[model samples]
Target: MNNFKFSENIESYLVSAKDIFISKIASGIKTRDELFTSLYNTLLLPGYFGFNWDALFDCLRDFHWIDEYLVIIVHEDLPTLSEEELRIYLHLLADACLDWKIDEEHKLEIVFPESVRCKVEHLLSAD
Candidate 1:
């Protein structure tokens, strides 16, 4: 589908959120550290960012400071993370999004290239 992909939770988020901010990362990003750095800078995260998945979840948990109801993170490259790492990353992001949607009425979305899209969808479907 040319339209944005939505699993059950994401669809709910879009239905309720008002404002949206789309953050895009062009190609060539590789490595977990680079992925974190790119996302941190793009999102204008708090200065306390710890550059780990836990820190990422923490930062995303309270992103109202960015002043938007929804955040869509779009990436054009695959990180150097292993398959397991990538799966965990996607789960963490999805969990954070769902948590925010339930508690703060905020939403988060992560979009990658179609190649990664299939992997992401598969990962999410597993849960």
Candidate 2:
């Protein structure tokens, strides 16, 4: 299964999945609080969610409550966070993508718009 990808045509990704859960994170998420709230509401994270980086990573990796075969997180735009926060967030996502790789029955995919493809790649590579 694909991990993280950048594409303008999100529909292409949706068309092939038999069972899919799509969560779109709207634009203008400028702070960690906004990001977490958006994730909690959009992904329907469990009540045990702890509103922190570690908690976000845990929720992203463990989606047992979701029944869909494919889970896709579509980021409309990058959050305007502090450099350190953004780095941590990106790495957490990369690590979660790696963890989800071993799940044969489930897939976690993150898609960013093509406009920010270069920025995302640069941020990820800076790690």
Most TM-score-accurate candidate: 2
> Per-residue lDDT of 87-106 in model 2, one digit per residue for the tens?
78888888887887654667
Candidate 2 global lDDT: 0.83
lDDT, model 2, position 43? 92
Return the TM-score for each candidate structure: 0.74, 0.88
Clashes of each: 1, 0
| lDDT minimum window of 10 residues, candidate 1 | 1-10
In candidate 1, position 83 carries an lDDT of: 76
lDDT of 1 by residue, 16-121 (tens): 3447766665566667787788888888988889999999999877876677777777665556677777777777877776665445656676666656667677
Task: Flag regions of model 1 displaced more than 4 Å.
Answer: 1-18, 102-105, 124-127
Query: Distance (Å) between predicted and true CA of 96, model 1?
Result: 1.1
Local accuracy by lDDT, each model:
0.69, 0.83
